[model samples]
Target: MVSGTGPETVPEAEFRSYYGHPVIKRPIWHVPHMPLYLYLGGLSGASSLTAVLAGLTGRHRLARAARITAALGASTGSAFLIAELGRPARFLNMLRVFKPTSPMSVGSWILAAQGGLSAAAAVSDVTGILPAVGDAAALATVVTGPLTATYTAVLVADTAVPAWHAGYRELPFLFAGSALASAGAAGMLATPRAEAGPARAVALLGAAVETAAATLLEQRLGLVGEPYRQGRAGLLLRVARALTAGGGLLTLLAGRSRVATAASGLALTAGALCTRFGVLEAGRASAADPKYTVVPQRERVETAGPASVPGR
Candidate 1:
């Protein structure tokens, strides 16, 4: 209706959404409990693997320590998971049916099997009630251990969470490395210095792998990686990388003294915990921001060309 303008033409907008609402539903998982569960689950899985390796190498004391660590971690982690579920009774229903397509279902079954195996191995080691049975249980963990360590990554990444789903390819590696480092740290802490060589090696290797995977994930993700570099998540990730890198370096020098070894192991464990918390926090942040969801979908649509119809 302007006198100078022939017509009041509205400019076409490139993208549209409903009132800044999130396109994807956010995960309802609570903090501390969920992150703590992830940390313990990784610890349990990695310790199980450490136990198997120790047993094979005739490092009986280390094997015993690993069994104890696995059992304690799984048992404690299950408690956190149940707390997250908001009811202990619901946890029992997880075993009613096995759904391979559902990560939660698969993880439940895996955790159940792991709990039984780790508990048996730990008990036999403690009471000498059934040494043969304990050895068999420990051996069985060789199958479940890797799954236990890596499946949480699958569980988290197989979601609508932008940061988690986008980084699915590298998440497993990150988680597995964290698990191995945790197991190694626990083994080193519990075992005598003379027998902690394998643990030290595992810790260093895991730290290196974890650091590399995290760097690649951040670099390759571009805009999706923003959440990881902003706010509390960024601080946590930065701390995690620093601790992991420093811990790995310190572990190399740990051969000189027991105090140095203990310090390195503690640092590695703390770093792994921080990594878990950071990843979870990043996902939460990504889901909270409408820009993360809307912009990505918009890019995909634009890249798909004229023939690409919406809502396909």
Candidate 2:
């Protein structure tokens, strides 16, 4: 309200949806190529957990490498995301006001803490390379690994995107599972046969979670889930399912041979990437259609509308 300006007068009334176009604002470039960050961060965190498990079980070399790589990846991926945000400085605004309802805010804090802990843990391992710091880093990862593996689904679910918003109940489970699988993959590659037991467990659990989530997402979404079941989204889903399954199977046999471990690691990594990309694509497609938007709103209105009177 400017003091010199005349009383603010309302203009002609118009009823229009925001960004009325069903399509999103950007071209294919807007596509989330870096959705790998989510995958990487989760994988990194899970790998750290695997490292911890391996360490507890007396797998020193495997645990050290896993912890180091996981922390590095988490740190790198987090940096990429912060750089990508429109207002990186506003990132701190995330902490200014806490809102569990906002996944972005929650994820920001999670990532921040994860980065510090992962770095500390990974760096601490350099006792051979930097003995003093290695000790402290290992201890810090104990707190960060689990949060890193789990918070990404919350980030996706907090959005207004139809696909993500509706699938809130299952996305965290899906992401966590995927993270576990990914971590297992890396562990299989880096760990000795005797030490990779926990990696196998994580992979199996991850595959189970991913498969269950995919089944539920496809079944429960009705029409809105179409994006995931068709087109590029469909392709991505297929690859994710296949890779996750293959990876899990490979993990089971990881103790037998190095080839299986390598295959499992690669497959799990591929599956994680496919899942992340597919999710982003599905959200884009869901937002791109007027029918999906209009029909749902109309259905809601009709169901809630006032009843008509026969006489009136």
Q: For model 2, which pairs clash? A: 120-137, 121-137, 124-134, 127-131
lDDT of 1 by residue, 148-244 (tens): 8889999999998999989999999999999988899898889988877777777888898899889988998888989889899999999999989
For 1-312, candidate 2 gives per-residue lDDT tens digits of 435767777686543456675434322323453587778888887887777787777878778778877877787777667666655676777778777777677777777777776677676676466645655566566677777777777766666677776788888888888888887777777777677777777778878888888889888877778888989988999889998888877777666788877888899889988998888888777777655555666788899998888999
CA deviation > 4 Å runs, candidate 1: 1-20, 308-312
Error of 2 at 176 (Å): 0.5
Name the TM-score of candidate 1: 0.92
Per-prediction TM-score: 0.92, 0.82
- Residue pairs in candidate 1 whose N, alpha carbon or C atoms collide under 3 angstroms: none
Q: What lDDT does each candidate get?
A: 0.89, 0.76
Cα error of candidate 2 at position 167, Å: 0.7
